[model samples]
Target chain A: MSATAVLRVDNLESYYGPIQAIRGVSLEVREGQLVTVLGANGAGKTTLLKTISGVMDPEKGTVKLEGTEIQGNEPDRIVARGMVHVPEGREIFPLLTVAENIAMGAYTRSDKAAINADEEMVYSYFPILKERMTQAAGTLSGGQQQMLAIGRGLMAKPHIMLLDEPSLGLSPLLTEEIFDIIRRLNTEQHVTMMLVEQNAAVALDVATYGYVMELGRIVMADEAATLAASKDVQEFYLGISQDENQRGQRRWKQRKTWR
Target chain B: MDFVQLIVSGLANGCVYGLIALGFVLIYKATEAVNFAQGDFMMIGAFVCLGLTNADFMGLNFWLAVPLAMVIMAALGYLFDWGVLRHMFGQSQVSIVILTIALGFILRFAAGTIWSHEPVSLETPFAGQDLRFGGVVLGIDEIAIIVVTVVLTGSLFVFFSKTKLGVAMQAASQNQLAAYYMGIPVKRIQSLVWALSGAVAAVAGILFASKGAIDPSSGLLGIKAFAAAAIGGFGSLPGALVGGLIIGLVEPLSARFAPDGFAGIARIAPYAILLIVLIFRPGGIFSQTQKKKV
Candidate 1:
């Protein structure tokens, strides 16, 4: 990956009404890199992505996309600037046919020939979407929906894709299948991605770098191999509690913070 | 022959009701806000068309006046959403209902100021023309209503289904946040939906004016359209027309076929159908849209 950052969130602070959800979080994803954010359910991993993608406005932050500050702009404007967010819970257009659902991803593009080629590229990434192209998107199984969600993101030909929990509710096998494609896209398609995942094992396996968040703050940041080797990550996030008896006591200790 | 004539005439009247109901349903489908002023919009549209075509007003040709009136209504509709309704976001649905009801009163008063309370007639190219087919007589106005309604409905279906903007509209209606994530301008699409609804209301108003004399009170006819929308299911396009047809058919048939001294209830037939539908299948006949599972 290049030293130039594709996305940069500096000291971002976001709130849900009065309560802050993402607190002074800073991260950067370099070009052609697959970065993962690891956090528990309430650590605000989703909110961080939401803020960066312009779905939620940040109270104090600068979201720079390719060094252009884009905080507080409308989501569509952010999307037009070449960042596509595949939101959590797979918010695919249900009533629309699967093909139409994919077509919506390319709503901003006007190049008819390039769009058709991109559609083919997306189908190649997820062949099942091609077979179910005419069917209503709602009919797809959960795993396929996740794949479709990612495929929809692929249709944008986005400069950076923010994936919020691609393996959110999928089976382990399906998560592996999706992560395989995610890795393929990063290496082959040169797609820069910042993926929010609680599935740390799979996430760290594919990510070039990872950030571990705790209570809306980044507690750790390191290269993927180093993060994977860290004993604290294995116990807390990776579910690799080797000894069942003292697991709680062992997790009560703090390792380190990024700052 | 008389029965066929009654059916045709009823269908024509239903077309007017159905067109108005379509506006009702379209707005409801996109925003989930019940626009109580839908009829008032029709009232204003008719008056506007009259003002455009009448010798006392703009004195434009009928063909020119119709589209012009529709365009005028569409702009007003866009303004209404941008100015009034946009602020009502996160407010209760009841608040929006009250807002629309107040808008209805204002529209009626404004229309009365422009056109007066007195009834008036509009000059149409096809006025007083009738076609007879094997002893069954049909007014050209009635034929025009049926033909126009069918054609408009077909075009709208194609627009929503085939076009990119139309598909974007469907996406916005289904899930606004998701649509926004996909780069669809949800707010603009919603404002456009309001504009489209206004244009539909204008067509209904013009057809209504073409059929007979009109006054400010003609907007009260929207209650039947509301009934039609409810009967068709609030969000279903085809259901609105079918519901309006039921009301139209029932009105004449109830008046003509009922026992003596019971004709007074003919006017309330639409409401009665609305009541029946509410009591039984509240989802309407063609309630195919389901809330998407996230």
Candidate 2:
């Protein structure tokens, strides 16, 4: 899976009505690498994901996927190009059956056999979906619906997935389960992922590289281990004490300033 | 009782109303926009059937002509998407609703110009016969209307529940943005929904025409159907039917038993019922309210 960058956002500016949500934010995702975008509420994490997935068109910068500019492309076209965005709220079709919701994820794929294989793979990851295949999606518990949302994205056969807040309203155990599945997706399938999450601790743990965003700007960007060690991050962001065996527990006493 | 016969007649009328209401419900479920043109689509269907079997255009048998008319209406629905609806896609809800009303006016005007505004009968296979069951007698044309409505509703239920395309449409209706991300051809599905609505409207029109005469003003029939939708639950299929039946039964009962102007009151009954239901349960009798995650 080693190759040049699969997705690159250069100086992107995005807007929601008159308000600028993302101002000159630039990021990159390399092949098979897990990159995490950590930010607080209203820091434009969702806007960034929307822009990269072509839901919100960039006001200033270019979003290049596989070396082609795709900043202003329609969502379906961007999806067909193999970048799937599992949106912030697990927006599974409430009225649709579980099997129908999964089938929709393969709307662009031409190969029926491959889609079936992917469906099987998704069912393997969340076997509960198989039990509830014909049941209405609205009937599922929140955690199960989140699993279905992820499974639906996988149906796209994405080269890279942009996930927004996968652990929003779940218990600690369910959150861990979600992060584990994400980690396995990255390691086993070698699928590139750009995760935007408020769960900074789990995100930092799993990510190869991390970016801390504040007020729609990237405040810090470094290897996950180094950023996790910074005193500034611990005080302002990752406040909880890191346990032993955690990769990014060592801290610098001195607070770091932005470059 | 002779009163029982009138009640039976009202029930049959309500069934037709239910069919039209189902079209409203189907389109509303798909788009969340009330199609004011739905009744016009019904009128178009009957006129098309009239034309096809009139010995002037193909002159086909009633059964053959019926399916052909539905097909033609479906095609017009596709054209409606390409012509008027496509422009209003993703616009505000009020704008879409207004656009469809404008389309309804256009359709009514066109039908008037081509066929004239006079009442016209569309001959059917069982046009003049009546069947007696016990003391109650049912006209063959009325029975045919009921049968057509039931058959079309069943087919639509199957189409939405069983087919791959149907499931996709349901997915799109629930959350269009998510459906788009999933790679469903969201635009095509919307168009298909419009087409399906048109087909259903045509069937309703044919049934209406079977009983008596239809004219351009017949498009006003959608108002009753809209009332039915409001009664049954605005976006529910079963609700639409139930609502329609309620309205249908009330008019005759009210006219027969109540004061002279009670028929008008009966006409307003569904809305009054809708208001009462809305006060108590905003989500309607059978429908569930959607929950939003923060």
Maximum-DockQ candidate: 1
Give the Å shift of residue B143 in candidate 1.
Answer: 0.5
Candidate 2 lDDT at A187 equals 97
Q: All models, DockQ values?
A: 0.73, 0.56
Can you tell me which runs of candidate 1 are displaced by over 4 Å?
Answer: A242-259
lDDT of 1 at A120: 94
Q: Spell out the clash pairs found in candidate 1.
A: none
Q: Please give the TM-score of chain B in predicted model 1.
A: 0.97
- Segments in model 2 whose C-alpha atoms lie over 4 Å from true places: A240-256, B1-8, B56-61, B89-91, B132-136, B256-282
Candidate 2 local lDDT, residue A82? 93
- For residues B160-205, could you state the per-residue lDDT of candidate 1 as single tens digits? 9999999998889887888889888888888999999999999999
lDDT of 2 by residue, B1-294 (tens): 687678777877888788888888878887788888888888888898988886655578988998888899988887887787778766899998888898889889888988889888887778888788888777887667667668877987898888778888888888988987776777888888888887888888888888889999898988988878887888888889888888888777776777775557766676777788778877777674677544
Counted clashes in each candidate structure: 0, 1
Query: Whose TM-score is greatest here?
Result: 1
- lDDT score at residue B81, model 1, on the 0-100 scale: 94
* Residue pairs clashing, model 2: B232-B239
Error of 1 at A212 (Å): 0.6
What TM-score do all the candidates reach, one by one? 0.97, 0.89
